[model samples]
Target: MKTEKPISEGIMDSLQMKTSFKDFNSLKNEADTLYLKFQRMGFIESELLELKKENDSSYLADFSLGKKFSFLKVFYSSEDFTKKELQQISSEVDETYFILSFESIPLSLKKLTAIRNQKGNAFARVKLTDFEKDENENLSATLFIDNGNVRTVDSIVVKGYEKFPRSFLKYYAGVRKGKIFNQKKLVAQNENLNGLGFVSAVKPPEALFRKDSTTVYFYLEKQNNNLFDGILGFANDEETQKLTFNGYLNLELNNNLNYGEQLLINYKADGKEQVNFRTKLTLPYLFSTPFGLSGELKIFKRDSTFITTEQQIRATYQIDPRSTVYVGYKGYESSNLLDEAIAGTPIDDFKSQFFIAGGSYIKPQNRKLFPVKNAILLDVGIGSRKKDGKSEGQLGVETTLNNIFNLNYRNSIFIQNQTSVLFSESYLVNELFRFGGINSIRGFNENSIDASLFSLINTEYRYQFNDGIYVHSIIDLGYFENETISIKQNLYSFGFGLGLNTKAGLFKFNVANGNAQDSDFSFSNTKIHISISSKF
Candidate 1:
């Protein structure tokens, strides 16, 4: 009883031998003899076979493999067959493997008669059309992925913005809608909307799948959060033979008024008559609650020696966009006008009220500017101060560290360290830990060392020549201590600098020559230090 012709008559006899192949070179010699019969059935060696000659009534065989060995020999089965004996030897080698595996070769005989009527199916669903490859090549990838079902996230569009605030870009793009379509959370929400400095580009989310979800769009590019910055500087202080002129001005207002609030105003001047004024306000989510708030008012003067005033208020908590934690309240006042031939010397005059705590971690390699590759800052505090009415007890500690070391793509190697301490046995000359010139210890004189304790270290080796120009070579080391001027000091400096990273920030010029000693190093002193700054 050997009679069984019915899977729709074997798909109508494979569509009549797929329309009697009109000999295009005998259908490329029967597709190179069915590519050696699918490599003798174990199918491996493939060099992306080709045949093309598609005009004279068809013949365009271009078979390819290596999408994981062509889905394991086209959906597996070959240890001497038996996936129903490899579907009866793949339906007698699927008409010469659909005339050498298709380029629409008569629609691959209706996909080889639907894989021989889905024979002994363990898995089958092959749909490939014009695939592509060579993405920094490991070669084997002619697109083939078929483990289905799992999409979700149906809806999230958000193209270009005008004034930001689609609830602050869906609250910093922690993508929501229905979940599950996470490609590493959409590339970490496009790097948290390009680190939100009013976003200047964020693309890469375009999803769109659909038969039950996935719509994601997100393309953004917005910048210009209103800012104005200015600075002009000139210096020459060879052991205080002074000749300095510096000026700065800034005004900013980010996020329009959409509640991610920010506003700043600053002014500085110096030709040795130093003056500074500041005003700030930042809110970034205080009431919406991811906690953040800032307030500041500072006024500093430095002619006869000091005149500082400050009022700060801070609160911050963002534990993740690179860490932060803060707390603050500072109300200060210092007014020492030196000159009574330095009367009663510890540089006096003060008023205080402080309560501060700080934290910062920042792991930035590039996020706008600065030579940051890693940053850490810490602050400790305790306070209670009242000048003449006597109340005392104050303590403060500060620390900073930065390290960078990429030695390619324009070389780098920077290290910075700063340390401060004040245990107040009467701490005022503008809170005391001063360190000298051009951002500290640069061959002295600018706040020329008077300490409660201080330490500084800077080492640099930059070298970038384009895009925000750079050139550096610096080394500075300083240490100062004061047990009420029983004093101990050490300073060493070396330098070279030229930087200009702008959009309105980071401009520098430095020159330093060393020497400063005491603790009986015979009271040494050598000079040469120049400085300039502009950090918008």
Candidate 2:
């Protein structure tokens, strides 16, 4: 080779010739490798190599780089493929577009073979046959493709958790019997199943192939995701002039019966004598189908002012493994517990019924105090409310988003945004939405505020020391409209919290103080929250 040759830099780079070799066989093997490399680059297969030994430690070689070949025209040979099979390939991919590197026939052929393999032709073979060479140094040929036997999923076998719900297999894992068998896609199906909180994979996913079908195997084990959690808040009561207890308790059970169902019970109290309690049950994959049902019952008592009872039921359809959409009905009935009605106060009893629709998506993340994961929940309802036998139209909407962004492995930012709205001409204190406390807005008592419309957002910067412990700074901002009194205001809170994850459970503690934008902050407004979540 000479420095002043017609070969371009790319051609020279493509020739990975070594400077020296230990033996004649070593030198010959390198020459053989280069032959295949150049042939893959459309170089003539007839290129010649000449070798000469000059001394004990030196040798010289010359390569006759022949003219490169380009395609005159290419054709896909579907003569042996069934019409149905051809239609399947055409629907998924354009068989004609795979001949991209027309000059490099082998490379193009490799692409064509891979496309077939993905389309259930696991043993397809392709070759350029019936070649006709032209005087211009180009060749025309038919790309004869032999699409081997088509394969489909015959069944799925679970080694460890044989009782796994079949519906979870078809809907959640996206792997169903009789589906197209693509080894590449099947290999990734394990992650979709393992990402679930209710189960874990004990062994690597495996596949067994047969002459006519494919069977995937999963070694799974059930995981306990049930939790019993409690929150304790200490806030000074202005009327009592003493610190009072207010918080919430939650018990959630999941997949207990292996039906992929969930049960939750929650209760909250705000030392102001307002107590809220709710219980919900969700049964997914009804009759081994994508449909599910969820029901909820809620009771709220505003300390002798009013007691409200609400019931809701939703019919849900699993959209994918991680998402679901639901349509539901919500009914509310309220009665003033007060002995006498107070004038100018919207504290009377009322009944409201709503038709609701919503959807939700959840994705799990690393098991850490401040894991970088994502979730979203939202719903809207249009219905009516009756007060003193007077009926009126009402609309309600609610949405919440929780997400975490990781700046690095140990550092992250967690943000949550929530909005709730209830629109009606007339207002009732008992029917307005309530959001406060450590969960929604720190430094405020649970269920302390009543609003017709409100938007709240929280941003927390966190540093995880390890899997168990993390520290964070909390910042919250919100705007609310209290339609009862026609007053609107902005609220803000600044705080710091620490979270600990242990074998026993997870614990979080926070110290925060907040106030409305129109008011002055007070150290006496400080609130402390401590919570623990234990899972079984």
Candidate 3:
């Protein structure tokens, strides 16, 4: 009696012999007759082997006294029964006591004893799940579309890839199944094909199939752009002296294309005996468009009989991208005879025409120490005078407000109004109401003064530096309304300046001192101004 069985009682006796052989309803008609005489043999259940007779009609079903048998030999045992009736004869009806059979195997090796060698045999062995199912059954590929397009994969055979990577299956095979397959625009044309700085990312390798069209390959990387600059400087104190220079170069195209188109040129020199020449085409994003269309065009020349032609056009209707409602048109023509004696009329064919078909309503607010102080601009116009027909039929209004503190500097307050209507019967110019220079009373000059109820109280201080230097200071008080009667005529002025801005031109060096005395002090006391690139 050698005992040792507790692998959970041999797995509960192999689940009680497979539930007693499926309760053998007679083995379902003997399972095709015991599967053809045990086709590959089975039933290897051995135990009780204590036999002794070679007699008694041939009895010898024993091998010492092992005692563990259950019964096998369906019919070839031949032991007449003596071994004490072969242990009471119940070895499952030992037809003749033959035992030891085997062929049935598989509950994953019932207690697996050991015996391997079958997959194409010769000592067979090779399988980590068949090398991961031959690398998940590799498919084969090649594809690209950086726009120049390419996709061709004729004969790419695949059953299973041996460890992947034949250049990553020829990059997911884009096309080659007879060529010409968009494969869905090869990853968005390789992410918009870019260069110099770098950029790219697009993926879709395989599995968008008609049959199996796999192709993908894109790997790229670089991206940077935004550079800017500006400069200006001008000098003058007369006595045949001077300095002028302005510069700028920038490129930040398509920042939403924010209305940009620039290329301007300007020139000046007192040392070179010449002082003006300009060309321009600029679109500073039309102030901010949504319904705004701004415009500018210019051509200028100097010393060669002074030449200048300028134009400006504008339109606005934001209504709320930050408030706005505007309409504008401006014109200025010159043949420089000192810009038509400072645009006071000899325009040597220098048509001095002014326009302002106006409409304005604005509320611009942006503050961080007065980024735009605050705005409220309202204007109107209707005046024409060519070679002096003085065909005036003009009515105007202007209002400005400001508040700013430090960092360079800023301060401003202004008010205005002008009315006129005289198509000539020359009552020595009977209808005229006006202000001063630089677009109105900046220390007096243009139109000096005329009465019919004019009023102005101005104060300004401005400064800037770094690319386009600037400086401004002004103080003036004006009043008028004595058309041969009623008293109220007062005037005063004081000005200071220095400015030079470039992307092709803008220069001013001024000094003024006025108390009116018939005005026109040839630029108050001293002046020098140049606005090239035709005042874009």
Best by lDDT: 2
- Where is model 1 more than 4 Å wrong at Cα? 1-316, 329-351, 355-361, 364-385, 390-410, 413-427, 436-459, 462-472, 475-512, 515-536
Tens digits of per-residue lDDT, candidate 2, 1-536, equal 32223768887787877868888999877776776666666664435356667788876666666666643355554454443544433332244422234444555466657767777777889887776667876665666878878878888898888787778878877788888777776655665666656887776677788765688788889888899987769898787688766877899998889887899999888667888889999988899889989999999988769999999999999998778899989999999888887876779878999999999997755454542278899999999999888999999999999998889977988999999999898889899998888889998877788999999999899898888799999899999999888899999999999998878789899988988988898998888988888989
> Between the candidate structures 1 and 3, which one is better when assessed by lDDT?
1
Q: Model 3: what TM-score?
A: 0.20
Q: Is candidate 2 or candidate 3 better by TM-score?
A: 2
Q: Using TM-score, give the best candidate's number.
A: 2
| Evaluation by TM-score, superior candidate among 1 and 2 | 2
For residues 248-337, what per-residue lDDT tens digits would candidate 3 score against the true structure? 222332212222234444333332223334444434324333354556565444444455566766665544322445566655465444
Identify the superior model by lDDT, candidate 2 or candidate 3: 2
- Candidate 2: 10-residue stretch with minimal lDDT: 91-100
RMSD of 2: 5.3
Can you rank all candidates by lDDT, best first? 2, 1, 3
Error of 2 at 293 (Å): 2.1
